[model samples]
Target chain A: MVRVALYTLLGVMSVVMVAPLVYMVSLSLQTEAETLSAQAVLWPENPQWGNYAELFVKAPFGDFIVNSFVVAGGITLAHLLFDPLVGYVFAKFRFPLRNTLFVALLATLMVPFFVRMIPLYVLMAQLGWLNTFQGLITPFLMDAFGIFLMRQFIQPIPDDLISAARVDGASEFTIYRKIILPQTKPALAVLGLFTFVFQWNEFLWPLVATTTPEMRTIPVGLTLFNQEYFTLWHLTAAGSVILFVPTAILFLVSQRYFVRGITLTGLR
Target chain B: MSLSARYARTAYLFLLPALVFFTAFFYVPIANVIATSLHTGPQADVFAGLSNYADALADPSVRHSFLVTLGFSGGVVAGSLVFGLLLALVLDQPLKGRVTFRAMLLVPYLTSVAIVGLLWRNILDPQLGILNRLGLDQQWLNEHPLATIVGVTLWQTVGYTMVLFLAGLQGIPETYQEAARIDGASAWQRFWRITLPLLAPTTLFVSVMAVISGLQAFGQAYIITNGGPGDATDLSVFHIYATAFKTRDFGYSSAQSVLLLVVIVLFTLMQLRAGKRGEVTY
Candidate 1:
C-alpha cells in the first residue's frame, strides 16, 4: 500500500512537471481560433506539423537556430580547450600566487553578467562589432565557471600519472592534451552542456548585441515572435518547441550528466 | 622536469588565455562600469561625485525594484526549501522507477527561462488561458505578480534544488539513520536530528544560488510582465536594463548595477558565514 502511494505521488508530480511541455505541443498543433477559444482545448482536431515549417517562414528561425548553435557551440569548444588547461595548471602546477589567482577567477563568478552589461555593450559598439557574430561569440568565449568546475574534477586525477609522463620526457602541453583532457571528459561534458544550454537560452545579451533580424538567436527570435503574434499561440508554441528540442535531446541523451552537474556545481 | 621546481614557466602558458580573457572581458569591463558610474552629465563626460548613486538611491522606483527583488528571492528560497526538500525526501525512497521520475522533474531546470516564462504567461493568461478556464480566473499577473514569478520559477528550479538535496542525502552515512532508529528514535525525530543537520551545507548552497539568481532575474520580467501592470515586477536587472537602454541613462544604470552587485556579494558572504556556523564536520 505504501509503495502504491509512493508511485502515485511521483506519477502526479511527473505530470505536473511535464504538463506545460505536453500542453505546448498540443497547443502548437491547434488553429489560431481554437487556441483563443473561451474553452481550453487539450487536443487539436488537426495536427499542424506544418506550423513548425511555417514558423521557419514567419521568421528566419532557421538562421536563428543556426546562429544559436554556432555561437553556443563556439563558446563551448573554447571552454573545453582553455578551461581544462587552466584547471590543470591550477590543479597540478604549484605556481606562486596560484591560490590567489584561482580565487580571483572565482570571485568574478559572483559578479553577474548584468553588472557588466552597459560597458560591455558600449565596448562592443566602440569596436563596431555590434550585430556581428564575433561580437556575440568573442566576449564570452571563456568563462570562470568552467575553469572552477574543471579544477574540481582534475584535482582527483592521480599525480603519479602526470609524473610518469613527465619522466618519459612528455612536455607539459602533451601531458595536458593526452592525460588531463581524456581524464576530465566527464567534467568537460558537464561544463559543455551547462554552458551550451545557458548560452542557447541567452536572451538579453543577444537582444542587446544584435540589432538585425539576420543575427537573432532562437530565444531572441522567439521573444520577438511572441510579441508580434501575441494572439497566435499555436505558432508561438511551435517556435518554443523549436527552441526547446535541442536542449531536450541533450538532456535525454545525457540525463546523468545534467543531474551530476547540478550536484557537482549547482550551475544554472 | 622536477616536481619541486619553483614556478614553472609553462604554467603561465596554460593560464595565458584565461588571463587575457579575464583582463579584457572581465576586468576591463568592470573598470569601465565603475568609471562610467562616476559620471552623470548628458554626454556622460562630466565627472560627478556620488550624486548618481545618491540620485538612484533616493528614487522610489529604485527602492521599489530592490524590494520586489527581495520579496521574489525570499519567496523562491522559502518555496524551494520546503517543496524542493519534500520532493528530495520522496525521491530518496527506494521506490521503483525513481530515476525516470527524477529525469522528468529536471526537464524544466534544463529548459530556457525565456521558454518557461512564456509558457507560464500562456497558462496564466487572463482571458483565454488554461488555468482560468480551469477556474483560476484571477488576474494572476496583475494582482499577484511576485507570487506568480515565484510560482513559475519554483516550477522551473525546484527540481534543481531537489537534486542537490538528494545528493546531500545520499552522502550521509546510512549507519547514522540506522543507529538513530536502533536507539528507538522515530523517523521524524531522526530526520529532524540527523538528516536535516547533515543537509545544512547543501541547503546553504541552494539558498545562495537561488538568491543570487533571483536578484538578477530579467527574462521573466521582460517577457511576462514587461516589469508589470505598474512596476510590480520591476526586478533589479530588468530595471537596470531599462535605465541603461530605454532611458539612455548609462551613468545611473551603472550606479544601480554596482549597487546590485554589492547586494549580491553581501548576501553571499552572510550566507557563507552562517553556513560555516552550521557546518557539521562528521
Candidate 2:
C-alpha cells in the first residue's frame, strides 16, 4: 500500500511535468481550427506537418533557428577554446592574486545577468554591437562559471604529468597543449554541452541584445511569433516545438552532466 | 627570474585572454552599471548622485513591481522547495522505475522558459484552454496572475530543486536512518530527527538559489502576461527592462539594477557563508 501511494505520487508528478510537453507537440501538429474550436483537440486528427513548413514562409524562422545555433554554438565553442585555458591556469599555476582573481570570478558568477543587463546594453549600444551576432555572443563567450567548472575538472590532473613533460623540456605552453588539452577533453565536452543548452534556452540577453527580427535567437524569435500569431495556437506550438527539440534531446543524452552543471554552478 | 616567478609569468600569459574578457565583459560593464546608476540625463552625462535611486524608490510602479517580484519569488521559492523536498524524499525510498521517473520529471525544466511560458499560456487560456473543456475551468492567468506564473515556475523548477535534494538525501548514510528505525521511531520521527538536520546544508544552498533565481525571474513575466492585465505581473527585471529599453531611462533602470544586485549579492553571501559548512558529523 505504501509503495502504491509513492508510485501514484511519482506518476502524477511525472505526468504533470510531461503533460505540457506532450500537449505542446500534439498542439503543434494540429490544424488551426482544431486549436481554435471550443472543444478540446488533444490530438491532431491528421498531424498537420505543414505548420512546421508554414513557420518559415510566414517569417524568417529558418534564420531564427540558424541564429540560435550559431550564437549558442559560437558561445559554446568560445568557452571550449578559452575556458579550459583559463581554468588550467587557475587549477595548476601558482600566480600572484590567483586566488583573488578566481574568487573575483566566482563573485561575478553570482552576479545575475539582470543586474548588469542595462549597462551592458548601453555599453553594447556604445560599441554599435546592437542587433549584431557578436553583440548576442560576445558578452557570454567566456563566463566565470565555465572557467570554474573547467578548474574543478582540471584540478584533479596529477602534477606529475606536467612535471614529466617539463623534464623533457616541454615548454609550459607545450605542456598545456600536449598534456592538459587531451586530459581535459571530457571537461571540455561537458562544458560545451552545458553552455550550448544553457545558451540556447537563453532568452533575456538575446532578447536584449538583438532588436531586429533576423538577429533574434529561437526563444526571442518565437516570442514574437507567439504574440503576432496568438490566435493560431497551432502555429505558435509549431514555433515552440522548434525551440524545444534540440534542448530536450541534449538534456536526455547528458542528463547527468546537466544535473552536475546546475548543482555546481546554480545556473540553468 | 626564479622558477616560481617564471611559472607565474606563464600562468598570467595563459590567463591574459580571460582576464581581458572578464574585464571587458564582466567587471567593466558591472562597474559601469553602478557608475551609470550614479549619473543622470539624456546623455546620462550628468553627475546626479542618488536622485535616480530616490526616484526609483519613490515611483509607485517601481514599488509595485518590486513587491510583486518579492511575492512571486516567495511563492516560487517556498512552493517549489517544499514540493521538491517531498518529491526527493519519495524518490529516495527504494522503488521501481525511480530512475526513469526522475528523468521524466525534468522535462519541463529542460525546455526553454519562453517556450514553457507559451505552452502553458495556450493550455491556461481563459477562452478555450484544454483544461476548460476538460471541466477544470478557471481564468487562471487572468484573475490570479501572480499565482498562475508561480504555479508554472514551480512546475518547471521543482525538478531542479529535487535533484539537488536527492543528492543531499543520498549523501546521508543509511546507518543513521537504520538506527532510528530500530529505536521504534516512526518514519516521520526519523525524517525530523535525522533527515531534516542532515539536509540543512542542501536546504541553504537550494533556498539561496531559489531566492536568487526567483528574484531574477523575467522570461515568464515577459512571455506569459507581458507583465500582465494591469501592472499585475510586472517583475522587477521586466520593469528594469522597460525602464531601460521602453522608456529609454538608463539612469533610473541602472539604479534599480544596482538595488536588485544588492539583493542577489546578499543572498549570495548567505549561500557562500553556509557553503563551507557542508561537512556534517554522523
Candidate 3:
C-alpha cells in the first residue's frame, strides 16, 4: 500500500513537471484558429508543421540561432582557454599576493550581475560596443566561478608531476599545456557546458546589449516575437521550441556532467 | 633567482590576462556603479550625493516593487523547498524509471527562462490555456500575477532543488535511519531527528541560492506580466532596468542597484557564515 502511494505521487509530480513542455510542442503544432477554438484539443487534429516554417520566414530566427551559437561558443572557447590557465597557476604555483588575488576573484562571485548592469551598459556604450557582439561577449568572457571551479579541479593533481616536469627541463607553460590541461578534461567539460548553456539562455544582458534585430540572441529575439504576435500562440511556441533546442540537446548529451557541474558550482 | 621567486614571476605572468580582464569588466564597472549612484545627470559624473537613493527609497512604486520581490522570492523559496524535499524523498525510494524521472524533472532548469516564460504564459492563457480549459478561468498574468510567476518559477526550479537534495539524501549514511528504526523510532521521528538535521546544509544552500536568484528575478516578470496590472509584479531588478533604460535615470538606477547589492551581499555573508559554522559539511 505504501509503495503504491509512492509511485502514484512520483507519477503525478512527473506529469506536472513535464506537461508544460509537452504542451508547448503540442501548441506549436496547432493552427492559431484551432488553438483558439472552444473545442481546443490538447493535441491538434491537424499538426501545423508550417508554423515552424512561418516563424523562420517572418523573423530572423535563423540569425538568432546563429548569434546564440556565436556568443555561447565564443564565451565557452575563451573560458576553456583562459580559466584553466588561471586555475592552474593558482593551484600549482605560489606567489606574493596570491591568496589575496584568489580571494578577490572569489569575492566577485557574490557581486550580482544586476548591480553591474547599468554601469556595464554605460561602459559598453562608451566603448562603442552597443548592438555589437563584443558587447554581449566581453563582460562575461571569464567568470569568477569558472576560475574557482578550475582551481578546485586542478588542485587535486599531484605536485610531483609538475616538479618532475620541472626537473625534466619542461617550461611551466609546457607542463600546463601538456599535463594540467589534459588531466582537467572532466572539469573543463563541466565548465564549458555550464558556460555554453548560461550564455545561450542569458536574457537580460543580451536584451539590453543588442538593439538591432540582427544582433539579438535567441532569448532576446523571442521577446520580439512575443511583442509582435501576442495572440499567435503557435508561432510563439514555435519560437520557444527553437530557443530551447540547443540547451536541451546539450543537457541530454552531457546529462551527468550537467548535474555534477550544478552540484560543484552550487548553481542552478 | 631563487626557485620560489621564479615561480612567483611565472605565476603573475600566467595570471595577467584574467586579472586584466576582470579589472576592466568586473572591478571597474562595479566602481563605476558606485560612483554613478552618487552623482546626478545623464552622464552621472556630476556630484549630487544621496538624493538618488532618497528618491528611490521614498517612491511608492519602488516600495511596492520591493514587497512584490519579497513575496515572489518567499513563495518560490517556500514552494520549491517543500516540494523539492518531498520529491527528493520520493526519488530516494527504490523505484522504477528513476533515471527517466530525474531527467524529466531537470528539463525546465535546462530550458531558457524566455522559453519557460513563454511556455507558461501560453499554458495559463485565459482563453486558450490548458488550465482555463480545465475550468480554472482566472487571469493568471493579470489578476493573480505574483502567484502565477511564483508557480512558474517553482516549476522551473523545484527540480534543481530536488537534485541538490537528492545528492544530500544519498550522502546520508543509511545506518542512521536503520538504527533509528531499530530503536523503535517512527518514520516521522526518524525524519525529524535524523533526516532534517543531516539535510540542514543542503537546505541552507538551496534556500540561499533560491533567495539570491529569486531577488534578481526579471526575465519571467518581464516576459509574463511586463511588471503589469499597474506594477503589481514589478520586481526590483525590473524596476532598476526601467529606471535606467526607460526613464533614462542612470543615477537612480545605479542607486537601486546598490541597494540590491546590499541585499545580495547580506545573503552571501549569511552563506559564508553558515559555511564557517560547518553546518554545510556532511
> How does model 1 score by TM-score?
0.96
Q: All predictions: root-mean-square deviation over Cα?
A: 1.9, 1.9, 1.8
C-alpha-based local distance difference test score of model 3: 0.88
User: Per-residue alpha-carbon lDDT of model 2 for A1-268, expressed as tens digits?
Assistant: 9998999999999999998889999988998888878788888779999999998998789999999999999999999989989989999999899889988888786778887788788888989999998888898889887888888888999999989998899999888888888988767767888788889999999888887888888889888877887788888888889888898888878887777766765432
The sequence of per-residue lDDT tens digits that candidate 1 reaches over residues A186-229 is 88888999999989888889988999888999888888878997
> Fraction of native contacts in model 1?
0.77
Which has the greatest DockQ? 3
lDDT of 3 by residue, A122-182 (tens): 9899899998889999988898888888888889999999899999999889999999999
Give the Cα lDDT of each candidate.
0.88, 0.87, 0.88
How good is chain A of candidate 3, measured by TM-score?
A: 0.97
Which docking band does candidate 2 fall into?
medium
Model 1 residue A206 distance off true place after TM-score fit, in angstroms:
0.9
Report residue B138 deviation for candidate 1 (angstroms).
2.8
DockQ of each: 0.71, 0.77, 0.79
Cα displacement (Å) at residue A198, model 3 = 1.2
Q: Which residue runs of candidate 2 sit more than 4 Å off their true CA positions?
A: A266-268, B270-280
Tell me the deviation in Å of residue A166 in model 2. Answer: 0.5
